[model samples]
Target chain A: GPKVLQIPSHQIIDMGQMVTLNCDPVSNHLYFYWYKQILGQQMEFLVNFYNGKVMEKSKLFKDQFSVERPDGSYFTLKIQPTALEDSAVYFCASRSGTNTGQLYFGEGSKLTVL
Target chain B: QQQVRQSPQSLTVWEGETAILNCSYENSAFDYFPWYQQFPGEGPALLIAIRSVSDKKEDGRFTIFFNKREKKLSLHITDSQPGDSATYFCAASGIASSSFSKLVFGQGTSLSVVP
Candidate 1:
């Protein structure tokens, strides 16, 4: 099975500071996604990126959030001036094609805003 | 509105027992449904899936029973084991004009298979 890798398995930062979570998707995967999960909650869709563009985003994707994959590098979620509500485990996922519902996800990055 | 719903926020089953987790969806356009399994530290992994065209899908000890008319699905784990204890999520997605689409996930059902 292909694996997605997330950097900084755990991060703690002050509220109002910038934070960037990195996701290294499978080598050949094209469609990338970010999901957020608070403690004991459902995994909520944040955004999906493909071909260097944001294809779809949910309301959970706040105005301060942005995503980009420069030069086919790591797909990153950057939050400028984080809020306490932004604290959650961020999981990055990718799939081979659009027709299938299967997704491969990384271990997840735990972001803590204090 | 919440597109997907799951039942039994927490379940406990003895080893070798059969565990059934229930799920239902509100979306009519969704054609594909997948179940994902997650542990404490790991990410959710694809466990199994059933399409609206089929009533059932089985893989090893895991089975998905779907009802298109009811828009409901269930994941049955046969001969449950302690190793099988985890949070299971039911997700649904529609077929887009493109090759892939996003998934709407239900609140997971936490299962504990006590040995």
Candidate 2:
């Protein structure tokens, strides 16, 4: 089975600081995605990337957020000027191709902004 | 309206009993429906899935019944155990114009299987 690995399982930062979450997707996966889930809310899509470009992004994706696949080694999500509401569990997932196929998800990076 | 909807915020069942989770969607273009399971402090994992073209799919103790016309689906877990207790999410996705990945997920239902 394929695996997606997320770095810094837990993070705590100041409200105005910047934090970057990293994800290592499966070796052969072509598509990568980011999702966010508040403490007691549903997980919402943030953005999807493929072929070194952003494919699709949801309304929840704010201007403070940016995503990129750097050098085929790490898919990173960087948030500038984090807000209090930004505290949540960020998940990274990868798929071989389309939605019909299975997706591999990382354990998730829990971010808590104070 | 939510693109994907799930019923019963939470459920409790006996260890040996069967548990049924319900889900519905408002998007007609959503042809791929998949269910995911999550434990505390972990990411969601694929549990079972069914396509709009098929009405039913089963794997091990998990089964998915899909109704394309009604845009509804259900996951039935037979012989439930304490280990089956977790938060379950129903997600849907459609073909993107380009190379895109668009996955719409439901609120989620927390199931607690008692021993």
Candidate 3:
């Protein structure tokens, strides 16, 4: 089975600080995605990237949020001047181009903004 | 408006009993439905899925019954075990002209199998 790895399984940061989360998607997976999940709630889609460009994003993707995979390296999500509401478990997912509708997700990085 | 909805926020079943979780969607264009299973401190994993063209899909003791006309689906776990206790999320996505579409998830149903 394909595996997606997320760095810093848990992070505690102060509000208004900048935090960057990294994800190592499955090998040969072209499509990447980021999802946010509050405690005891459903996971919300933040954005999807393909071909080194953002394909689609939801309203939850605030202006402070940015994503990039430089030179096909690790896909990173950066949030500057974070807010308290931004505290949640962020899961990174990737899929192949086969259109199987299956998105392999990582264990998720839990962000706690205090 | 919530495009995907699930009933019974929490459920508890005795071991060896069958547990049924219900799900429905409001989007007609959503042709793909996937059910994800998640345990505490872990990410959700794909358990089973079905397309609009099919009425039923089964794998092992897990089965998905889809009613395309009613825009509803249900996952049935037969002979449930303690290991089956987890939160199940129902997700839907539409494959438009492109091969990629973001999935919309429903408020998950937490299932607890008691021995």
Q: Tell me how much of the true interface, by contacts, candidate 3 captures.
A: 0.66
Candidate 3 residue-wise lDDT, B1-115, digit = tens: 8999998899999999999999999999999999999999998999999999999999999999999999999999999999999999999999653676998999999999999
Top lDDT hit: 3
i-RMS for every candidate (Å) is 1.5, 2.1, 1.1
Where does model 2 exceed 4 Å of error?
B96-99
Instruction: Chain B TM-score per candidate, please.
Output: 0.96, 0.95, 0.97
Write down the worst ten-residue block by lDDT for model 2 chain B: B94-103
Candidate 3 runs further than 4 Å off? none
**Candidate 1 regions off by >4 Å?**
B96-100
DockQ of 3: 0.77
RMSD of each: 1.0, 1.4, 0.8
Residue A96 shift from truth in candidate 2, angstroms: 1.1
lDDT of the candidates, in the order given? 0.93, 0.90, 0.95
lDDT tens per residue, model 3, A3-111: 9999989999999999999999999999999999999589899999999999999999999999999998999999998999999999999999888879999999999
Q: Compared with the true structure, what per-residue lDDT tens digits does model 1 show for residues A4-90?
A: 999989999999999999999998888999999999579999999888899999999999999999999989999998999999999
CAPRI-wise, candidate 1 is: medium
Best by TM-score: 3
